[model samples]
Target chain A: MPQIFRRSANSYARLSLLGALLLAGGLIGLIMAIGSSSYVTRANEFIEQPIQFSHLHHVGDDGIDCRYCHTSVESSPFAGIPPTKTCMNCHSQIWATAPFLEPVRSSFRDDRPLRWIRVHDLPDFVYFNHSIHVKKGMGCETCHGRIDEMPLVLQQNSLQMQWCLECHRAPEQFVRPRSEVFTMGYRPAVPQSVLGPQLVKEYGIQSLTSCSTCHR
Target chain B: MRPNQNSQFRNSQLPRGLGRWSFGRWECAAILLCVLAAGCRQDMHDAPRYDPLEASPFFRDGRSARSLVTNTVARGGLREDDHLYQGKVDGQLTDTFPMPVTAELLARGRERFNVFCAPCHGRTGQGNGMVVQRGFRAPPSYHEQRLRNAPAGYFFDVMTNGFGAMSDYAAQVPVADRWAISAYIRALQLSQRATVDDVPVDRRPELDQAPEVRLPPGRPETPPAPEAR
Candidate 1:
């Protein structure tokens, strides 16, 4: 009778252990698969690009247009990646030298999008609309830093919430006309007393610049 | 599960009573394990049956509570201030547009009423909503004499600003919706009044129709015959 009871106890203990192990393994797998997308590559730091395309030689030295590569900087929220066709517009005839040509060739052959490393990533809470900033005469370099000058683009300023708040704190200081949005060195055209008072009265813009405007 | 009782059960063992018909050590261990397994229960009523606003941080304060100062939120409780814009923010209560008593508006008002008002004021506007059923004080009926005589503006003010235990619905209900609800309240008041002669233009929205109001028992609107003088 004692032997029967001990066998029952040991069997139940083994079953419980197996159940706990399965539960723990399932939980760990769920966390990992959810945390990292299997189909997409994610990187926190600089990723090796398909081509070591020199923004230094093209945009910096030659003073080429940024829109020449980035097709939708002005219109779209995403300053979209230049399609392989776009890269081929120049590189098709002149693929002479750009070491990382293998990744670009692979992208064209496999129909895979070039996974450009994001230098700047904003937190989920802060909603910084690119359209408004782009329309309000702020240039790409204002927030993104000297992207036109960097060879391998890296984040210049800490894109912290406080950093964005500092500008929103006083829009009168940085904001300019929509035409001058891409003008890197441009400042607000008019003084606060000269234009701010007039615009405030005309637009009937109430002070909605509260915490809920951004937080909620 | 707490181990205190299980430890006590284990300690209660006294050599299995040292005689016949006594339980063995394994039986004692089994009983102790069984005691530990039966001690975990959570309350189901934690979800609270009442309206969430009644339990909001602002109204539950025993003493005067200063709500966080924001442009949107009017500071003191509605009646606390001089019955105006609460004076903290730069706005007027009457700056809102007048709500037209259309059928569409009434339907919307009723939907809003159920979502918001039905918690405190019943679906029939009898002040016997679920909260009242759960032992809360019922809000006054819309057909009350004082409220019936009250202007649409007054109802809008009360709804937006709140009165007594009620908190401001300004945040919960929009300005246009507040006026629409006021118009609906007036309709309810008119329904209970029973006579068309006493109904104002704003209250007599459904005068051409029956099935509205339905007229209590025997009180029907009878026009007096014209006498030759």
Candidate 2:
């Protein structure tokens, strides 16, 4: 036969096989890169809310307690969003006419709620209760990172199943005294290893690994 | 062969680029099947049900919350204890707690008070809370004569039914919690007015260590003679 082909068919076949292997490897790396991207985890992303309320100003500088805003944390499954009346309790006097606080003012005047966008939204399947965790001596800072330091709130933790299971498996590592549950800058008075076990017993927490604890 | 016969022979054969350019019929069918399969399976996310508090257009009221017919209470919803639920006996506010006040109850009271009352009432119940500083109507200090002598039920009554500018905490605070907060408020009142004699003899020595009294900033300190140190 005349030399119609560029090279032997065998050589072409080997080159194609190498290209196929390289392509498969590249595809897998791309998938992993996407899986670990910020879009998936939402880490360090500033979530916009109706008000530009700075935690740095309220919680850090002014020394207002977290409970002042998140009122139902210790009593209910949901951490209650403060009604406009709560904001007006202060803003009706201080910052009464600041343009930035107009939304808050309007909401108070109209009796309509300022619909704040939720930052740490868990999926419906996960049954997380703020009260139970708070009562059992978990600090607000444990799941929500240094919130007082943030200008605009962001979801700091991944809040994935694997992340949840880490704490659930070893709750002693995270548990504090009930008195210190609301203390944002809480540290163990004794070392955590020595104190954690005693707290777990004191709080009557059963470190549950059951799927139904969260899934149901 | 004639030129027309040659052209006919080439046309009848398969196109030369078929092997390199196109997928087989089976491969195209498989891709189409996969695309259709992906489109069909979204049942979990789009399940047929109303979310909690979702508005219903079918109802005339446009509310998902259906009111109880006339007066229907759910199981375990019957609140029969007058002392526990109403904080009263016959018609007057009772002076006693329905349940025994334990250390645990006091702790719960402290937590609940900090969250609900401390914004307006101050953590120490001094009526100098953040809201008061920012100029809401300042509530009277719990340490004042009027509140200090008020019965425990009086505090509960105020919380249960709002007094003056304050709104009722009945919705925010459960009945048992109202009692607990009342107990805590009493403790706070006593804390401010407590005398040195009120301290236990064994603990009295600890209080004898005079706390360092630093003068306010910008005031000149009058130094005692060098020997007074």
Kindly give the number of clashing pairs for every candidate.
Answer: 2, 0
Give the alpha carbon lDDT tens digit for every residue of A1-216 in model 1: 123356688899999999999999998898666544422223223445546666665555544456545545655655655656555433433442555576776666675556554455544454555654565555676676655567776656556445566666665444444444443333333443465445444434344467776555
- lDDT, model 2, position B183: 88
Off by over 4 Å in 1: A1-50, A96-99, A185-208, B1-229
lDDT of 2: 0.79
For B1-229, candidate 1 gives per-residue lDDT tens digits of 3467555666577455453356789999998787656532223313333221123333434212234656554555445342233322234433233534699888767756765576667777888865556455567888788776666667677776677656566655666676677667766776776676787878687766676555322123553333345
Alpha-carbon deviation at A73 in model 1, angstroms = 3.3
True lDDT of residue A170, candidate 2: 91
Residue-wise lDDT of candidate 2 within A1-216, one digit each (tens)? Answer: 345357688798999999999999998999777655667778779988888889977787666778766777877778877778777656766788899999999888875567677778676667789999998989888999888899999988888777898889999999987767766666565567889899889989888889999878
Q: Pick by TM-score: which candidate is best? A: 2
- Tens-digit lDDT string for candidate 2 (B1-229): 5668656776667687763456889999999899779866755533455543345678875645465797788899897877777777787888888889898888878977887788779999988887677667899999999888887888898888888878777766778888999888988988999998899999988886889876532122653333322
Q: For each candidate, give the TM-score of chain B.
A: 0.45, 0.72
DockQ of each: 0.01, 0.21
